[model samples]
Target: MYRILIVDDEPMIRKGLQKLVEQSELPIESLRTAENGVVALQRIKEERPDFVFTDIRMPKMDGLELCQHVAEMDADIQVVVISGYGDFEYAQKCVSYGVKEYLLKPVSVKGFKGVLEKLIRTKSKVSSESFIAVTLLEQWASRMEQAVWMLQDAELDLVLDEIQEELKTKHFKLNRVVDMLAEINTLLEQRLNARDVYVMQRDFDLAGAENEEAVWACFTAAIHGYLEELKAKRKGKLKDPVEEAKLYIESHLAEEVSLEEVADHIGLNPSYFSQLFKQSTQETFVQYRTRRRMEKAKKLLQQPQWRITDISGEVGYADHPHFTKTFKKYEGCLPSEYRQQMGIRA
Candidate 1:
């Protein structure tokens, strides 16, 4: 539901607009009114409405002045100016301020309805929920990003699971969450060195409330703080144990990386190492390793230069059929189809 603020000097006009908005059956969370620009500006700071509907002429501050104040505070809120004078000049000014529309005086119910319909048709702009969610996802992704340069199977899946749950709960917007995660990962990689890069993917998860927006913001902040902390500890170099394991995997991508081998390499018993891997990597060790292998397979198949057998060997798959099956499961397409779709040909 979008909150709307009506800023009109006339009591009757304010009441009329309020009534029309209510009658439209739009998702109106709140309908607030301000008699003048001063009062409107004060309300503007206190409340984040989705739109502001104002009269062109008024004492103290006119519609134009009120708009300027609101615009300075937040330009995203749709502004609809009410003008009884039908003055083209005033309408033009409103347009210049990025007003949604200029409504003529004695705003006819039909005309009001038409404009309202147009507004409803327009895509929704950013909302408070999104702003908060984006912030949290960014944090979570960034923390993982700092801990592992390459995403791992265990923890990455867990994070995705949590996000899916958030979406199911209707706490977060799916697209926004994914976008924020992508952005944070990209940003983290650009800022960190190889050590930090390799460490990030294994080290982050959602630590905030499951509420979509809150979770997103908290996750984002956690990563930011962790990165700063890592930088401080390593004298600007990445020193995470997770980074050590990831670098090992990169160097041995073509080699078999069993859970036992990875755990043993990190000096932990097999089961304990698996647990550590899940805690850090966010997925089971086997799952993460399989993803890493499939990812390489996908990249290799995209080249006209690499054969299925060669790519399979490179990704530590002894059998071509197994590689093909895994790639299909993870990427939702067979390697051949994926390559063709990407415009790659042998």
Candidate 2:
């Protein structure tokens, strides 16, 4: 369906023209009517109509003046003028403005038919690519909310499926694109859930340049809240050994973290502590500690003052190469690359 703009000062004339355009065989699905040339220019820029029709003697601006301005603005549009007179001199001036067709009113049925017939043959072919771009925009909007939901559910495969379903009307090749984004979101989620690192970054962004203290304060509040929620859910309280062992590991995240040390801290056997931690967090104690440390490593990388080796040591990894490999295991990209992205955005 081609876009058509009606530029006439008279309300009745504009409405009649719009209705006629929409009723035409060429499928004028997006027809808009503007009261004057000023309004017509605004509509032209916004909707970018392929075809325009205007009366000759509108108040504040006339048809020939509008034609010249439209050419100066975007010469691609097709302009047809409607005049209440059969004046040759006015037509001569309009020709210089690139006015394709001039009609003498009252607009006979035969005249509108000719104008639309020509538009179907010329304007439709010119706007096909733009129409496809618009359809793709429509598809993205249609998928955005649902895609976000699928990601939050940890359903990465479901996200791609939803994108394919959403673009069924447009038949867009969105499956691979959405799949890649889902993978990124999964990594981001892992980091977010690990010691609340992503939440800290989000807080920093929201708190602004002068509010570093405020960001930290918010993070502290969220941590207290998460702890309180755990206390409230007595029925699903974490495995027995985790009650003390996990707390020990969190405080000692910058050291050579050991399950045996954590078990000794909590007065539990090391093997029992390991199994209990997995039952509580759905991850082995070592994997959980590594993930949490990598999350901190990413946050440390955000600061300009920290070196990668220093951050790696600070996050409890005794071996720098080992830290790099594990960070890559969870974050897809290397720590340095992630830091580069943070700096670029900053």
Residue 127 local lDDT, model 2:
40
lDDT at position 238, candidate 2: 57
lDDT of each: 0.66, 0.62
Quote the positional error of residue 205 for candidate 2 in Å. Answer: 24
Give a tens-digit lDDT track for model 2, residues 130-247: 3234444334333432333233322323443453444344432222223223333334334435534223121112212122233233332332222233333433555555656667
Per-residue error at 334 for model 2, in Å?
Answer: 56
Tens-place lDDT digits, model 1, residues 182-265? 466555555555554334332434321323554454444444344344443545544565556777777788888776676557
RMSD of 2: 18.5
Question: How many clashing residue pairs appear in each of the predictions shown?
Answer: 32, 0
* Per-residue lDDT of 299 in model 2: 83
Q: Evaluate model 2: give its lDDT.
A: 0.62
Top candidate when judged by lDDT against the true structure = 1
